[model samples]
Target: MELEDMPLEKKRDGDGEGTSKLVVEAKAEGKQTEGNARLYLTGCLFFTLISLVLMLAVIVLSVKSQTGSKDCPGTGDDGRCWNIFPKIQAQKLDCHQCGDGWLLFENTCFYLSTVRLNWSMSQKNCTAGKGDLAVISSQSVQTFLTGKAKSFFWIGLKHDANQWRWVDNSALGVRYWEDNLSNGDCGLLRGDGPPLKNWMRASCNSKAYFICEKQHTSLLTILWTTFFMYIKFCRIYGGDKKDDAKENLSSQLSVELEGERGKQTEGNARLYRAGCLFLTLICLVLVLAVIFLSVKLQTGSKDCPGSGEAGAGRTSTSLTATCNFDQCQTDFPDIQHQKLHCNQCGDGWLPFEKSCYFLSTMRSTWLMSMIECTTRGGRLAVISSQSVQTFLSGKRIGLFWIGLERPGSQWRWVDNRALGDSYWDDNLSEGDCGLLRGDGPPQKNWMRAPCAHSAYFICEKQA
Candidate 1:
């Protein structure tokens, strides 16, 4: 009976040992599975993080390309390309300020006079203040001044030499004249009527309050501010969010992985929550990126000012999408029939077909010619119509520079319009500026010349 009991006790001990061994093996296998799951999760996370980083890099590079250092026609002293007119329209980006008692609007500063004076006296006072009398070129400008005007204000328009013209000698663009007003040479803005029809003809000697306008001098500073602000915002709001997400994910994983098998379901639940949070953050980032790109495109393309010939000094690339010949004709009716005897273009300028053409007697390089034309508030001539071509050809006595230039493989006008009518005298493939040969016929007189070569140039502006 004792021997039988001993054998039974040994068998019981063996059974206990076997049970312990099996439990240990099960625990080891569970640990291995958990380790593998963590490894797989980490790999997926790492790949996702890398992909996010790469995507962000692509976005940054694309933005940089748009605002890159392409040569602007008028570079500032700091070697930075600054667009004057376009920057004006971006008032929120402006860092400039007007003087005391001056009102700031767009890219210009205006000052309302406290005293009444005649047109000549008002202009003289404005000039003394380093500005000119208010010149309203658009309906927005008219509305702005109309809001500020309490009484009759002397503007820069005048019926000079039989046609309405601005003080700068530019022909009126959009008229706001009230037909019932008294006839006179000077222009006045009446504050009591419709904003668009408040203008009235007044005597040059009539006394009235005046408005003065001057261009702001802080363009370069504004550009520097905008560039740095954009970079800083991108760093703060664009790229750093990903790093925060990575840190949060790491913290969550460490906290959730601390427990054993009993907490396995809880760990998986935490992991799901973490993954959802990460995915949500990523989705938010993508949405923000899309919004950023949309705004950049709109501001960089559509709303950019200085796209026309008058404002193309900063960006040599013109955004004029259509041929302006018909528009020019529409703006000035019967422009071809308008008498040249009006002398509206002043001395040395010849008026033809709603535009004024000035042939420089002195010779200059193409770039210098463009600069000079810009200074004179005009551009190098763009010959669009056959009549204009005949007129320009007839006026030229030598190789004269025009506004046409080959920015790329195709020749384009300075205003960025594609070359429409061809009058090439030679198949010249090398040179940047277009030259009109005076000796050849109008139909076949165009020539290409080196931009660096000195030649007579013709400047044109709205007459």
Candidate 2:
């Protein structure tokens, strides 16, 4: 109650003091907030700087590695380079130079000599140059050498043990002898002649230009380059540890895939072999079944009704027994005689009387024709009768050889029968062998000709 009665100055002073206290407290809170903002900004700047430095380091390392790889040498005129890694370099690297004036073909270097030399001297010169005489194994190689050879050239072929063989003890497969010559022991390439008639035999002492051959190099440098390129590609794609892990995983996956492919291939091969075996077995079974059915049918056909014992013995009798169609028709009334008569002649012969005749359609020498007839258990036709001569003359359309020959001064048959009556067109005793001349009359169809001449002949056998 006493404070309420006091003047407004006292109230004003109290209010002023409370206002000052609130202003001071707000100023302290503002200072604390500003200091916290500065600390947070400084931490953010530090983190960004650290990240930038790490990225710069990675870029510099990558550039250096690229530059070093690009600096590798040996990539000269051919655009090929040697591998830096010793392990990679050891694997089938091809780094050879075919010397000056030498031509490279496939994996071999060839040198055509300009100076002429004997075969022995030329081979010696080739050996001195770390090569050997050119050995032509294929047509393409022969063609190449022929084109290069401006003159006659000595080859690696030589006659040994009565046969042509290569210098390296290999036998010749294809021959290109000119005119089938059997004169010289050494082989030569006649470059001046046509391509087909380029090879000929010559004396070894004859002087001629020659060819030399040696291995060039293997083609494995490309693989080495590919390996290094793969490594560079991995390094650029990802950082060291991560990319290494990725590459390892990729390698493992590739290995697994390759293994799986191999297994699949093996499985397919096994399946193919099994299928072939199964088909073979099925075919064998079918053949056996057909044979068994055929045997059963044959057995059933032979078993006549009410003739069980006799039918069983028919197999032994059929081999030596001659079937008389008249008797068969009387005994078995159901049997047909005409069908039985059709099977009298064996297989491929024309039946006339009791003998079968095979007409001549192939031409051969007289001696060769006789040999063929003898193989078939027959001989040339012996025209002892006029009817037989007429039959042979009527069927022939050209001059055909017979068994008659004049081995001595007299004409005789191949079976040593002397010539009885002469049916010659003239008394011409110039030739030695007899032939059935179809161009003349049938009565005088016999003529003499050389035995070495080729003509068709007839063969006769019993039916």
Candidate 3:
């Protein structure tokens, strides 16, 4: 609502401009007063608009502060909408939070993953964990999982029992598995295991570790031993306290409980934020990758098979099937990318253009970045080729170092190459644009925007 819409304490400035002092005036004439009211109304409208913009900006920032990360599928507690972070509506029930490739239904985790191990070993492991090969019944679960794994595995069902039986020994429900037309076949999913991401068929003697599903609920409730419960019990039993005393106690208790809750909440919030940020970073990487892949797919006509692990900074050439969290490792190694090259040259450097570029460590004036890069026996990276441009294109959105800047604010190329016209963003000339690391400017479609703005910097020197 506009401020003018509500009656406010009246105040007005004197007509004199330079003589600034506290002064209030009331109109004597009705016509003049009406005019004054109109002016006030107009001012109110203008101020209201400005207020609205600021409020919206704050709200957006607030939302970003809370929800600024990627979405996760579970929160141990029941979810609340006002939470700074949001959880994925679906509960992830994988063994040890191994999210994407496994499914948890009922009290067990089922391997929707296409990982290969002997059917028997997989069964024994699942049996040890109180679950068995997947006995999927619902179409939704099947569709949700099979879409990713795109293959099948030996489930708990086997032919030795002389009947279609699940490893759990429970009566088989309606099975939605599309048959391969084998009459004596046991339960099987159409998938091969790790490294292949393909399909295979075999007996139950497989020795792979089975993924068992469990509910999102923790093992047991310790609420009775918790601080909140203790406070409640104390409130009910403490009778001799005065009403005011009781209230004070309750308030203090409430604060303590809230603080405790806040601690958990904040902890979860931080976790959520971290998860989200990681996810956001992942998604951003994925999106850029997808774009690049799509481009590569178009150019290569789907003939050049790319390795996901190789793309993720692994230095090995072997096709790795899974991630190893103990060490920051991915599947394929030996495949080379510009970023991988930088990874090859450690100490906050990323490889690009057959040269090492420093990571963005802190924002500095262009002069500062140049000096630092120079100290490292390099200049700010000036991306010169399509290969370099494409490599940098896949990086996170930020201002980063490049080997270009205004010397004496002349806005000339460092190489002293004769120029036909200056290439800069926003029509900025030598004076307005100042300096650029990339030909494109900050947030420009092709330009990385600014250099040395993030907490990291990239210094590059020729090989």
Candidate 4:
């Protein structure tokens, strides 16, 4: 009777305890699976967000590469793009082809003759080449010719009928004539003398080397130079590292997803599938990024404006436009600003310091010259210092009406600034307007002249 009772009690205890233990194990397993799915979902979302951020970074870098590093204003319809980028047009090699033994400078080709010839013969030779003898139109041209001149060189200048004239019949606006004005009518450039006063008159029959110039063909080029620069930058800044990091992260995620799939129950299998979908989405994003970059790399716009090309005339309308002309200049100063020419100051102008100067070919009265400068959005040049005076004197061969004027008793600039440093040739209280005598010493070149006197003038404006 005792043995029978013991067996019954043991059976009841095993049934109750074993059932409770099975229920607890099942609940624990379910909780673990839910936690793993939540973790995998969080990881997928995090990686997706990271991929999105990386894609955006690529887009931003590509845009920055398209435009220059410096932001400029006054280029867009809303006044937010850089005027400098458009100005940095790359000339196509095919468009500007200088003959062998000729040097390309700006839009013109220069050739220094090996044989010596008289002024008349030199002019004839240049005409034969469809050009003319060297015309010192600006200080830059003068400098260039001076650098190339080994000895005396006959230029396109002759003192005819008391006035110096170029081969093209244009009166000499800027001159580099030496102090000693000889009786010779032809112009000779002295390579050994000071650059400012290298020109000396000589007989037309005197033998000397010559220079020839001609206009270049039209500008034709695509703006792929900037795009290539961007490609170079990406190559330098670890493009491979970025790809490797992306690949490594994606591979790690794939391995983890596979492990999750192997360990998960049927319910958690959905989570594994979702992770695979997320991975596909990431790959799609990567593919899209590649496509976007490829398209951007291939589609660079033409930079040459007024070339009659459809894309060349339109300005950049990106969202990064925000700077004005003045602001753009102030933000990014050019490294070789002093070397720049018409590109900085425009045609028929010279850049000096922060100013652009225009020496007029047409002569007019002092008042009329002032009016001409005003109409051209400039004013008569103001000689404020010795350097400026020297530069002005070195640039011309004849008298020019400056901004100086006597309004009442005191001499003042056209801008109403009181005369500080005077460079008067004589203290004669005779005329109201001032004339800058280019042939005289820079320190004592200013002379009072009649306001009604006709002469060439220098116009000044901020560059």
Candidate 5:
């Protein structure tokens, strides 16, 4: 019977015999299903761990981007990190820096300092930083500051102006102080201790560093303060004068900005014009090139000088060179690199010991003939002209050679044109060559002997 059709107990226990196998078979199947469920739970936990790690990586990247500092502070209103740096606002201007080194009370300012430097150098450094030394105006304010100012300090008081003066060069007034001195060229504090509030003068050279202050009064604040002072129930006296002053200051600021912008605009215009001209010139050149190419195509090659004829002209010209460089090489091969003033050669040949040669041996290839010189240290016998050659040829009782050659071969020489037409004496009539002989009836092959041959071996050397 089919497994599905059979009764459950019969299939599991197989016929009956009191075996009880059906219940054991069912328990085994239940255990297999439980194992599968446990595997699925383990796989889900691993995937969950991977998702958590990826989420953490994204958060760390976001925090780093936000906290990084790139641009410098104090650059226009974009400095949104105002709270992180010291900021002071007065009127329409905003100034942010470290902090004010000087303190102000009532109408006057004061400072207490520690380190000290020389007078001139200290003034320079402070000016560079846009501040100056302390100037004590009133006796009470001075006394309070100096009492707290323990160490020696410099002040803006000086007698170098031909008389005593404060930082701004105004004469010291006795109205604000209990006492005053004409030549008080130095600065110090009064002896009032608990808040010893007074100013005194000591030596300026004594080492000290003092405080300085710069103040800017807001237009709004000034207006309110003035209004409160002159209040006749808001009658407001002198408001017109204050407004006129404010307007003047604003106008001056605008003028300065306009001047700066005018210069910048003019510079930009010049740069733009230069760029436009450069591009226009480039376009013009390209158009001209196209026109030139069209003209060449329409004309014959010989007329345009650009078709295949250009190459033929080069080869033809090279072959047609009758004499190199416009001169008859047979007569003046060594004439180049010469003084243009040299209209002609010097008088008769520049005769050495026994032969005639050109006065221009200085231009000859001395290196080419070094191996072919004679025992007496003579070289390829140079002849200034046919007359000199004839004399050398006829006078040689023994055969001597001159620099003459056949159509091809070593530059073997013969005793002038008068030597026997048979140039059989030369080693090979085919390579760069030369010859040497002594004064005598024509002899042959003697030219190939080492020019180093002893002087006694030849007629010229026999002497």
Candidate 6:
């Protein structure tokens, strides 16, 4: 009802109630607005924190990339810089490239001298080239030197205090001594003989050619260079952004880059898996081929027997088979049958008196040679008789290891027999084992030598 048409007391009561309801509704609307404002502020703060975290992650990644690059040096025409993200042109290096006139082998460079010089002077020449006299350490290296050395050449070996040593002050572990020499402080390699019989001792003042050795550029250097280049490329392409608009743009770019990288990583993974599978297949095929070849070889050997006289000798009824095809056997009925006896020596063994001897073609250490002989059900040859010694000395042209050894302070045979009727060389001063000197006199052909020296060995067994 209108205020003008209402009674005074009733009108006052209705107006107070309406006014109170309006005040309560106004308070509720103000609280709702405040809550909405607070929620909006909280959402803004959360987004800002997330953006900051993403920026921090990017910075950390950049720092790691930069730190990793420090270990790798610069290479190529652009110094240390690279454009990896854009795939721009950059220089590459071949780290294994050797210097001019230097031959590469494994990870080392070797230079052979054509002119002659004394041992000291040759070492000086090698030092001038930032290298040392070639130190022979392996069979492959020894073979290489043997091929290059046209005549007696000087090596890094020197006799110090009656012991042979290398230029690096390392004691010789694997020796290839040709003979036990009393004099000569320097080492020489004979270019004419086999590799096992090449090393010999000579005077230090003797003039001869030499070899120099040095390390070549390594693969690790190339890997480091590549890593540095990649880091430089990342720094150049992933520059920093300040404003939000630029930051958003960079975020989009980074997302795209990540997508590309993911795709590339997947592709590389697939390629690696495929390569592994292909190699596995190749290995399996090779294994199958080897098995098939081995089976075929065994079958062929079993099927094809010895031919002609050998076959006839192997058969038990040779006369009956020969008589079955020929009437001439009836005409020569006076022929007598005889049984032949074979030698008692085993296969690949030489019969000498009541013993079987085996000469090794390969060179090995004294202990290793002993193992080989034991594996063959024998032991190293014991020179107990002068006739046996004379026979062995006549057969070998180079030093051959015997069964004699010096276990404690005295010389004894492998059979634990004491030294009797010794044939030791007069000039022998130091050594732990005895060797037959094939180039020396028959009466004094035995000489003392280090047990570690590589030489052809002799094994003996009962006949």
Cα lDDT tens digits, model 4, 79-186, are 332234443322211211454346678878787765465788778767766778887888888888888877788888888898889888999897888988787999
lDDT of 2 by residue, 280-299 (tens): 44345444544554454445
Q: Model 6: runs farther than 4 Å from truth? A: 1-96, 180-182, 218-463
- Comparing 2 and 4 on lDDT, the stronger one: 4
Residue lDDT tens for model 5, 1-463 = 6776678867655544323343344334434543443344344334334433433333333233222211112222212122122221111111111122344555443433323444444454445445566665666656566556655455666666566677777786642222653234665444343333244565665544555544534323443453353244223321111112243444334444444444444443444344334434434543454455444333312321112322232222121324332322222222121111111112332332223242222212322232122211223454444444344444434433344433244333323233334323535333233333434323333343333222221111100
Instruction: Give lDDT: candidate 4, residue 149.
Output: 76
Candidate 4 residue 427 Cα shift, in angstroms, is 6.8
Residue-wise lDDT of candidate 3 within 366-427, one digit each (tens)? 54555455444455556565566556545655555455544343544333332223334554
**Which model, 5 or 6, shows the larger TM-score?**
6
Error of 5 at 65 (Å): 30
TM-score winner between 4 and 5, please give it.
Answer: 4
Q: By the lDDT metric, which is better: model 2 or model 6? A: 6
Clashes within 3 Å, all models in order: 0, 0, 47, 4, 13, 0
Candidate 3 residue spans exceeding 4 A from truth? 1-114, 127-131, 177-180, 183-185, 191-202, 205-212, 219-463
Q: What is the lDDT of candidate 6?
A: 0.60
Worst 10 residues of 1 by lDDT: 87-96
TM-score per model over all chains:
0.31, 0.30, 0.25, 0.31, 0.24, 0.29
- The local lDDT score (0 to 100) that residue 355 gets in candidate 3 is 66
